[model samples]
Target: MSVAVIGMIAGMALGFAGYFGGFGAFLLVAALGAVGFVVGRFLEGDLDPGEFFRPRDDRRR
Candidate 1:
């Protein structure tokens, strides 16, 4: 699925695990997921739009 959905699921899993086992593991995984989401979004924004749609070379009126 989408990166956001994956991030939420991972965060929930880590949060629950932390609740049951320890705090450090949970924080670590949750932080990782959050950072992944942020970085993924940032990189996605930098992609070339031409990859999605062909460029229009015509410039005449």
Candidate 2:
């Protein structure tokens, strides 16, 4: 599946969610989608959890 197809499906899902499930459901789906994307990236080893939580070593001397 291409990125465009994934985006289209996601858009359609959000549209259906907004049209039928209302704004709250739309937000919930969007948030969950974002979390899922991140988790997927982590699972694929394309994302580094430490990148987000690790403290910067560039502290001013």
Q: Each prediction's Cα RMSD?
A: 9.0, 2.0
* Per-residue lDDT over 1-61 for candidate 2, one digit per residue giving the tens place of the 0 to 100 score: 9999999999999999999999999999999999999999999999998889766795665
Candidate 2 positional error at 35, Å: 0.5
For residues 1-61, what per-residue lDDT tens digits would candidate 1 score against the true structure? 8969876788679878798869887778778777875677668896554555654765555
lDDT score for residue 52 of model 2: 96
Q: How big is the positional error of residue 25 in model 1, measured in Å on the Cα after superposition? A: 0.7
Highest-TM-score candidate: 2
Error at 18, model 1, angstroms: 1.9
Clashing pairs in 2: none
